[model samples]
Target: MKGLVCKVCGYVALDGNKEICPICYAKNVFEEREDAYKMPDFKAPSGETEKKHIPDFTVVEKCGLIPGTGCVDVHVKIGEVLHPALSEHHIQEITFYIDNKFISNVMLTSSINPAAVIHLKGGTKGKVQVIETCNLHGKWFNEIEIK
Candidate 1:
């Protein structure tokens, strides 16, 4: 299993040739034999995702305050707004709460975006927990957050 990486996970595929990573199978795997880089037409930004504004989309990150205390960030649409100060030409909000207590709100605007919020923050939490994200629809296509 030395060079074995999950086709869908990019992690060492412990079980071999499977579309899913043994580790992420239950939580992130969509189907067997799926490519990590390949996204279905429905999930990608092709149809309704591009034209409409998905609301209340959130990403939750966890920390030490709770065993799984997390923070939530978002991916929203800019629709038709322009701001030189913002980088991605789009705007998103982050509704943050920890241990069930309301915290401060923040904004995320960037030109360079990477990883599915689920993929990037999926397993990022650790012992005593640090960060966990729960995105409503931004996983593979379109979503928004308003904090």
Candidate 2:
């Protein structure tokens, strides 16, 4: 009946300090506290530069991502804009097949758009195989390679 009281978790305290009471520990009162939450200094403490980009090895171009299967969710950039004749939506199935064995097909790029970026199955983080392709007249060209 003296200090502030927790409305959400129903935690009552006579004195409100920097530390939170045990009853409302699960609510993480410190992070949501108006008085406690202060704007931290944006500058790094010493020599902290930009964080390195950790690639998802599992969903890269090198590793082929199977459809309908759970794989690493990643974004793949395949092929360049080669055909001005084909507008935006024209890519159907720009894939390559040899010997009827299906050596390698289109993993990302499609005719609807210039590039085909899809989420892999693994959904973890690793290198995946992506084939770059382009649509010319009617034939699809697979050129770029990534992993």
TM-score per candidate, chains pooled: 0.20, 0.25
The number of clashing residue pairs in each candidate reads: 16, 29
lDDT of each: 0.30, 0.31
| Poorest stretch of ten by lDDT in candidate 2 | 47-56
Off by over 4 Å in 2: 1-72, 78-111, 122-125, 137-147
Per-residue lDDT over 12-64 for candidate 2, one digit per residue giving the tens place of the 0 to 100 score? 23234325544445443432333311121237531111111111122253444
lDDT tens readout by residue for model 1, 1-147: 033333453332222334444334643343333321212344565444333222223344442233453443333222222212234333343323323222333344454331123212334332110111112222122222223
The candidate scoring highest on lDDT is 2
Error of 2 at 47 (Å): 37
